[model samples]
Target: MTSPFDFDRELAELGAAHLLRRRRQVAPLVPPMDLQPDQEHLRGTTYLIDGQERLSFGSNDYLGLSQHPAVIAAAQQAAARYGVGATASPLVCGHSPAHESLEHELAALVGLPRALYFYAGYAANVGIVPALVGKGDAIFSDALNHACLIDGARLSRADIYVLPHRDLAALEAQLQASEAPRKLVITDAVFSMDGTVADVPALLALCERHDAWLLIDDAHGFGVLGAQGEGTLAHFGIVGQGGVAPEWQGRLGRLVYMATLGKAAGVSGAFVAGEPAVIEWIMQKARTYMFATGAPPMVAEALRAAVQLILAEPWRRQHLQALQRQLREGLQAAGVPWDLWPSDTAIQPLVIGRNESALKVMAALDRQGVWVPAIRPPTVPKGSARLRISLSAAHTGEHVARLVEALRQAA
Candidate 1:
């Protein structure tokens, strides 16, 4: 039986390399309001990890609407009406009014004609990619795209050409070379690990020239970038059909936009927005969407509230920008012995060259009552292991100062 698969040896190897992943039971708050983020106190951003309190920089709740009174109230109301679970697939009576409303709002926000919601970002990508492209097609992917996108490309059974990250010339050349029946280009709007943004307008232009489909996974951009928090498209002034703003528009030929609500929106689930016909095609053909149970109606309602908060509370984005500058300036002044990679977004990566060293830094911060995740390969490249410090609007200036001080001590 091939030596019983050698589970123990494989696990031991993983452990030895400082890459064995483990989960600590994390309570979202430090007190009895544990399930909720305490958004009004000095300990507002604290989390109870394995029963120990730690000021955390490990969450993607960028706009901090997860525990807003309005969001919570909306969820409570929906749960009272529809119960907690969606109870069925969207095709089998699970697509409720809340979901439909949320989808419409999402489409309009992104300037697309329609949108389809998914239970998670991963599911959306893995399903949408294969739904629209298959064996005879070709997919051009960015090297640093998220795992979900990579998995989707692999599953599509299409010819995948992975160009170097952000190498537009190489991508163009590859597109020029591919003579497949159909061509698709896939990339992350904001790379998860490094926090660098893709040149989306240029990519879209290239796709148009080559008559290819462009898919942008905006997991890290939605609710974080743009004047109205409309994600990366808004940041670059690319508006589509049904988009109300008179933002800059190009020939937008064929594009598919996907963004998650769980990150900056501070809720659960994701949505794919594009032309109505394309969305209908995905809904009709995607196995993940057709077979899986929909997210609860309460989640849909909560996301509605989150969407409103995103549009109404401009201060959150402004405050976030201020905090980013503060953190960057403080760290540069401290001369911390690691590279703080450049980013214009909320996700900040401090690159520590070796795996063990990154973990050491994480441990040091943890000991100082602060928590940031040590991200190692295969999440990142082998030598570029880092502590991915994610900030949120819930965090205060004092919180940033505390983290800076702790890092200075660790250094």
Candidate 2:
């Protein structure tokens, strides 16, 4: 008889395929005693792994606000006052003033009337999708949407039509043919792995024509795009200072905008913002939110501070853009022999085309004190394995230059 599980065989298969994933134990940077009082408060961007300081190009701290003194102070004050845990689900007694204020701020920033917080982005998507559509309903999803959205669609038990990545024609064809009573179109604002942005205006127009609801998970775009970091909608001028334009207001009832805090926001948790009634419905229905304990109040407070920083510090976004240009130009000038994906965002992929080759390049970069992870199947498609170089405002020109030189040498 076969054993209950074939764990050993699975492990061997994964190892042979060069698909095994591992975690690196990293140490946070500490300020040197020799630094001045003001300088000492600045957060160091480098991380120590295996007793070596490596210039990390894998972080999601886009604006470098994770260690900002104001964010830290806000977190500290909240933790001291509210302790480290909510100790109950939000529906119970877990909802705190911090959570409430953060939700309001997030809703305002995204130009939505209301917002509901969740423990994380994964939970938010999983909860919201199922709450909105199920059984006889239909969910039109992008082929390359994040796993959270995919899982949510699966859990909803709806007829899921995964149109080819960014193929608006295919999506429209499906929308035109679907007979389901409720149709929902879900997509990521920024494709996380490839870093390509979705055309929100086009999607909204399609949704309107088909009488469908649009749910955008702007996890990577929030705090990294637009003049005020309002995300991809603002990047496309679909939303303005007065909020989503009056023309788009008719579809606002069905627009569900979700974003994660842990990435560009430099904090924890996630939120779903939409019309008041839709948000209220989700609050009453999303199982993940109803069952799980609320995120710590301190994290919510820190996120509030992060929002303020994202709004006030426009220079940070400008500097990040500069770094992006520097890296792209340097890579082109160096003539590195890899297929670089076209992306204007923080994520830049150097496609190596084979799993082993991507791994070899990553190892070579590691030897040169540059830390960029090798992205392989099933994170990306087969025959398109790559080195995902994630940039941040914390990185400098020198850091980017060093990375370019290392890539040249590695290539």
Candidate 3:
């Protein structure tokens, strides 16, 4: 029963290159016997990693809705009414009123006509791309697109042209030269690892000119961007008018909007929003949608509460901005040589360069009871390994300062 594949040696090679990823078990800090006033908020940003309490700069709970009492209560109530599991695929009787409501709210939140909910963001992309374009079609993706988009393009059987990151001119050049009958341009509304945002308005314009569909995965942008956390579209003053914005209104048909509920919304699923006809087509044809079991009703309900919080409370985003400024300023004052990317968003990347160096810095912080992970190659390009410091509204100013000091000490 000996396997032909040299798995051991292959793994050893990966380890040697410091490219092997290890998962650290992490969980909330159970409140102390003598608890503080805002223990729930403290719990969300602090974690017990490997039996030690640590300040976490690795979470995507950007607005801290994950710990909100309302969100948790909504899930509990829904569970009592509808039970825990969804039992079957959406096409086979798993879809519920909760799912429908979340979808509708999602559509309205993004200023699109309709929305289709998916159990996961990855499923949304892989399913949507293939449903939109196939063999004779072309997909022009950003060179720095998330893996889901890349996988989706591959699944579509389309000719994929990866344009240089943020290079609208190059994207336009390809669109102009392409002869494919159907074309799709896919990008992340916010580049995840680098913390940089896509110029979505420009990308949308290009897609419009080329007579193509623009699918933006706003996983990092949703619940974090915009004046009301309406997302990246609103961030650019282009989307979210309930279809009344004159300049971008006519072009809404060409835009396929998608965002995750997990990061900023503090829930566990994703949804695709667009024109009714287009979403209908995707819902009908996306294999991931057709076959996967629906997310539990509890999740849908919890997301509803999360959405309300995102709109009702503006302080989360404001505090997040303050934290961003604080971290950047602190790092600058410390004079760290590595570049802190020019990102005003919550995801801040400190490029450490080289796998060993990145891990070294990460380990140094771990020793200081800080839990910011080191990101290495394939996640980011080779030689650009970094510490992707994810800031959350749950994080305090003190926490940011502690991280800055830890990083400084490590440096």
Candidate 4:
């Protein structure tokens, strides 16, 4: 009998290209191991995924608030007070006192007049883009932006220009040549893949020259960077002042900031903060905002507590920074090639040119009880397969040392 499918050769070619995907299960009773159906064992960094113990370095819970007693307690209390679900879309009665209260707290934290929440970071990006720009508008984006940002720009129906990474000159040229009715420059404050920061001040200057609005998605930077953890804008000390870019001074009000709570905040959901008119416009126009259910009240409560912990417990950030410094310094001292180790942030990438090499390294580390994952194209550029090493506050210096030792042994 003839097969129904005809792409066997092409499929095999893809496998040969190291682009195939698969999964494994975590055994019951293994701490932090990911338990998936139909598998005996797999690696994981969190102990309670399906309820097990595993040493985790793969999670984005940079501040380690995911299991923080206070944060968990807050979530429990909120669920007890508000119930298991919000019941309906925020526009249709899901917006509760919990949501409102979190919004106020987040607004104050970011030094903005208002903030609007979304169920996920991707939804927030998609909603914000379409709400702000349309058929006659334009968006200048960084080339290595997160997938959500790329998708959001595509959904916006605006003329989108992807500028070279951190190339202000090229961006200015694009802005100079464009005559779209509205202009928006969007970027991830920290590139998730490479862990590099965006040049916000330079972008702000370029925006002023062309009367464009700037949107900084601080998904990775939000709860880990800046004084008081306000994010990249504050990290660079450019948010509150009005004189750095005189042409953009008062116009700084047009700088829109959006961030996810799932990373350093160790919670779920995202929000956007900006001028009253812009937010009001989104409330009235963004489909995700108007149609989707609000973030769960309990998640908001957890995030509120997470934010407080980030601010009150500055040691978490300090610890994370120190860990990064130690890891970088130790790796350098050990003669690990710097060219292979890119990223100053906790999201260190141990570049392995071949996907199989990266996966092999990951397997070797996993056998030693570490859990960094192999990232390959198309998630990254071709020939850039890497072990994406993410650090968390929950980890100790000893943990970092162990990973470094494992890398040395693997090498």
Off by over 4 Å in 4: 1-13, 23-54, 240-249, 337-342
For each candidate in the order shown, give its overall lDDT on alpha carbons: 0.89, 0.90, 0.90, 0.81
| lDDT accuracy of residue 105 in candidate 2 | 95
- Residue 373 lDDT in candidate 1: 96
RMSD per candidate (Å) reads 2.2, 1.8, 1.8, 5.0
Query: Model 2 over residues 174-287: C-alpha lDDT tens digits?
Result: 999999999999999999899999888889889889999999999999989988999887898767668987777666776899999998899888999988999999999999
Cα-lDDT of candidate 4: 0.81
Reference-based lDDT, residue 51, model 4: 38
Predicted structure 3: lDDT:
0.90
Off by over 4 Å in 1: 1-4, 30-39, 42-44, 240-250
Question: TM per model?
Answer: 0.96, 0.97, 0.97, 0.90
TM-score of model 3 (CA atoms): 0.97
* Residues 1-411, model 4: lDDT tens digits: 647685787778778987887764433243222335532222223443223345556778888777676887899999999987888888899998988988898887876778988889998898899988998899999988888889889999899899899889999999999999899999999988789999888888888878999998999998888767777777787653232233334666768889999998988999999888988898888888888777779988988899899889889888889999988887887776424456767687778888888888887777776767788988898998888889988778877898888888777
